[model samples]
Target: MNQPARVLRMSYLVASLAGVGFFVLSVAWLGVWPARRLAEDAKRTGPGHVVALTPSEARGRVIYAREGCAYCHTQQVRFTQADIARFGAPTLAWETRADTPHMMGTRRIGPDLARAGGTRSEDWHLTHLYAPRSVVPASVMPPYRHLFAGGSDAPRQEARDLVAYLETLGRARELAGDEGEARAATVSHTHMEGLTPSPVLNPHPARPRRTGEVPALPANGDRARGEWLYARNCAACHGSTLEGNGPGAGGLTPRPTNLAEHTYTDGRLAQALWNGVSGTAMPAWRDLPLADLGALVEYVRDPRITSQLRHDRTRPAQGELAFGQRVYEANCAQCHGAQGAGDGWAARALAVAPTNFRVQRLWGTAAMRILQTGIEGTMMASWRSRLSGEEMQAVAEYIVQLYRDEQDLRAREGRR
Candidate 1:
């Protein structure tokens, strides 16, 4: 038995066959087995209505894979406490039913993109893709400038396709709604118990906030600190001078608000800071601490910021008040509400909520211009075709008067 065989024998053949058999077993156990499991899960996903990719979305997925996007951002939301906290529920196997090769990466050099759909606006995506640092100053993401013809506004077909794919990241799960939550609970019970029950896909500041939740600010705020925060976070889209002409503003629809030209009530600032303006590119700053948010409020409400608007405002004559009221009731009340609190009968049906005139007042000229041109990328349409220039001016001024205080009821009828 110990003697070596010089010629090929049964033992030699047996050893070779065993080695080949083990190799096949490894491949079957590791690769093919897991892939089959994925396929099965895809078929029976909790969200039964998994949407197939459109041609554009498919093209975008190819571009995403080609760009090696998975290296930085992961599509998988693992069953961990940390992942669940920021990104809502853990990713379901069925959520990614359409993913062929799958983008469930292990590394998270950037945030997980499993719930990226509907978090940011398309224009925001375009600007960020064109130049990451412009929108997010601290972002380490390399610019995908080649995706655009010029700036972010001029996105190529490839860029549009990629964005379309991004918008579908968490669609199936969202569409599943309550059933998906129940499914998540059933499926995730084995991995971790006491999971957070969040209806929203992602709870991060990057998510566009549409809720009415607002945090109470401190009585006093540090203007200097607020200024610093504003410069870092807001200046990119709102402009250094708060003119809505920042480097990243080109891509945004309706553009960024001219912060300096808008007189914002404290409550308005709080709402904006906590929940962000719905239907626009403005994202909530809920990630910021209360103190930091307070500081920003102070900076925004600073006398310097409001000075230009206050002095430039030219209120309509007393005679125009009734005319303005009639004009507003006829055209604006259906969406903007009778009281201008952004809670009109048809407000819920709109993609973008009507502007709350009670909380935010714009300068007269800027208001008129907005009325003339209408706000692009929003439901606010031009009044140029419907109303005369004087009528627009009257309604705009009336809208400004709507921002008065509780004690200023004396001016409610423009008597003051």
Candidate 2:
């Protein structure tokens, strides 16, 4: 019995020692070793060097954490098929090497922020931060209005800093180019080694890729349904009146098309809705049913059917027209084309093509506004400094007359 008691005591001691040894091993293997490896890897991997956050970016990161932006937005792109399909290649471990706490958020209440940089213009961000609904009528994300001093047009220093920080989010990865991506693929867990990665990962991956072919429209469309759809989707950017003066229009570069004045072929509408306009903030609505898209097109083609409208009914006074004609010849003809066809000598060089005034009927007041403020995101510059109010009004009136002349000429030719 005493010998048995001695054996039991010895076994108890051995067990305690074994437990202690296991704890030490776990700490070294699971904690210390991994941390050291990560540190070393940070020094070597990613664009071949560590990407230290700039002072402004660091401050912005602090703000991002404090604001709980991570609660809604995720920074990590997982290895799952869905994530890879949507966010481009799987995120490498070394990609977050410079991140101190890391912004790999737990949930995705909003879109991923991993590839947000350079996807949108600065103005779009400013307006969005000020009032999400202003630009995206259906956005569930809350606005960061406090970031602005007054209007979206006038952002405070903090706002600028925040945007600057935002602009840096996916910049390094994009700047990494193909070589950096290839280097990362070799060491990353996802085994994306050797294959060339897409140069620019899409920020809004929910949108369909451009297929170059317009989706087919339904055989027949309901104008009423199209009206409702237009109000829901197009009105925020294109304006409720189709005048291109929506609350969000002011912020967009290449301001939203004045749909009422601009005539588009059915094919152009289909293509724009299906693939979105490149180099613009317009998003593809491929998720919508074909019938809905057809209706949207129908409604956009003739918005006047659903609602009563008001326009300047009075024709341009002859003196006003004569003065406008003189102004058009001297100043506007070079860019607007002699016949207002948007085929001016300089039109070829412009990124966003000039407006063809002959095809569409512009609101006189809207034309004056364009002259005063200039269309943002295009070659058009504000004439506020160059022309007097009377001259601006005269030129705007002349532009309206161009459409009238074209319509009258077409009517006469048809009769003949």
Candidate 3:
């Protein structure tokens, strides 16, 4: 062999060995060493330590990845003012220490899932997964209907596991409680980009606080604007006809309000939008402008008052009316009041006050169903066992007549 050929061969051998050495060092420092450190630290059982996932939650995590939920939802809350304000404190390193292949997704087509642990009830999550639009009118999320056995209410084991996994996200950090917050505040690293950590971390502002005060509605709203707002934001759940038969209505338990059948006071409408109904999928729309809020209220009221005012055409026989009156006095009067003004003796004792029959209307079929099934999540109970079908029909008709009388009186008062 020539001298130049031998030199080239020698250089190639040296280069190959150097490349192999670099690879080994990189693996040790970047891959093995960090993993060992993480394993040691993650086993910690201190106040700020991430809790080990239960067997069910671990299984759920697998399901979450299998379903490709990570493609749309991110488990990380970025270190920014907007993120902190919207989704609590920024995610810490320990928060994701337990995840094998981290679920910090690449994109965010939906809201961040980092602090979704206690934001909503399990039922709400199940319903949302089964049919996203059922609660969120404009949600673009695809339905996971296959996860359910029958309906949104009936989720199979995988569905339950998936929900269980979701319930674990950011839970450990929250479970850390006030001490964790104080610890985080004391840590120099917690302050980022000159941003101070919030004293109280509110993971979910959308969840309702149990306050009794009702929000006030804006006055003299423009109906045209209100109509536009309603079509854009509310029509999917409330229906174009304001009948609560919107495309997404069927999956919800207790269902959407039959806007055409009921008269809601301005305060009720305003408060419902502002705070969202607790134990339901309704979300708070605090981001909406004051004018828009007023407009929505006006739009909701206009159709009910002008076009959809239900006057009970069913005049029951005298015997039926007498029987209905007798049943109402015996059973419903304690909660509905003698005059149906929602001021019965039992009203104060109930969490949700009874509906004033004088101000509210119910369709015959709906009233019948209420008599049979009762209103879930309310003080109302099924009277199907106590009242015969005929009695239920008569009482419903009597209630409808009461609504008609009240409507007439209101109209007369407006004219005067």
Which candidate tops lDDT?
Answer: 1
Per-candidate total of colliding backbone pairs: 0, 2, 0
TM-score of 1: 0.86
**By lDDT, highest first, what's the ranking?**
1, 3, 2
lDDT of 1 by residue, 1-416 (tens): 44466434577788888999999999999989988876765555465466788999999999999888899999988777777777877787777665789998878889999988888888889999999988888899899988899889999999999999999888888888876676566556566666555556667675666776676898469999999999999999888888888888988996998887787777888888888777777888878999999999989876485564556555567889888998999989999899988888988888778888988888647888889999898888888999998789789888888885542454565774
The CA lDDT at 6 in model 3 is 93
Cα deviation at 152, candidate 1, in Å, is 1.0
* Regions of candidate 3 where Cα sits further than 4 Å from its true position: 1-52, 133-137, 149-154, 188-190, 196-200, 203-205, 212-216, 305-309, 312-369, 377-379, 387-416
**Cα displacement (Å) at residue 154, model 1:** 1.0
lDDT of 3 by residue, 65-100 (tens): 988999999998777878787787877657786678
Which model scores highest in TM-score?
1
**Every model's TM-score:** 0.86, 0.72, 0.69
The runs of at least 3 residues in candidate 1 whose Cα sits more than 4 Å from the true structure, single-residue gaps closed, are: 1-45, 193-200, 303-306, 312-317, 406-416
Distance from true location, Cα of 268 in model 2, Å: 2.9
Q: Relative to the true structure, how large is the alpha-carbon lDDT of every model?
A: 0.82, 0.74, 0.75
At residue 163, candidate 1 shows an lDDT of: 97
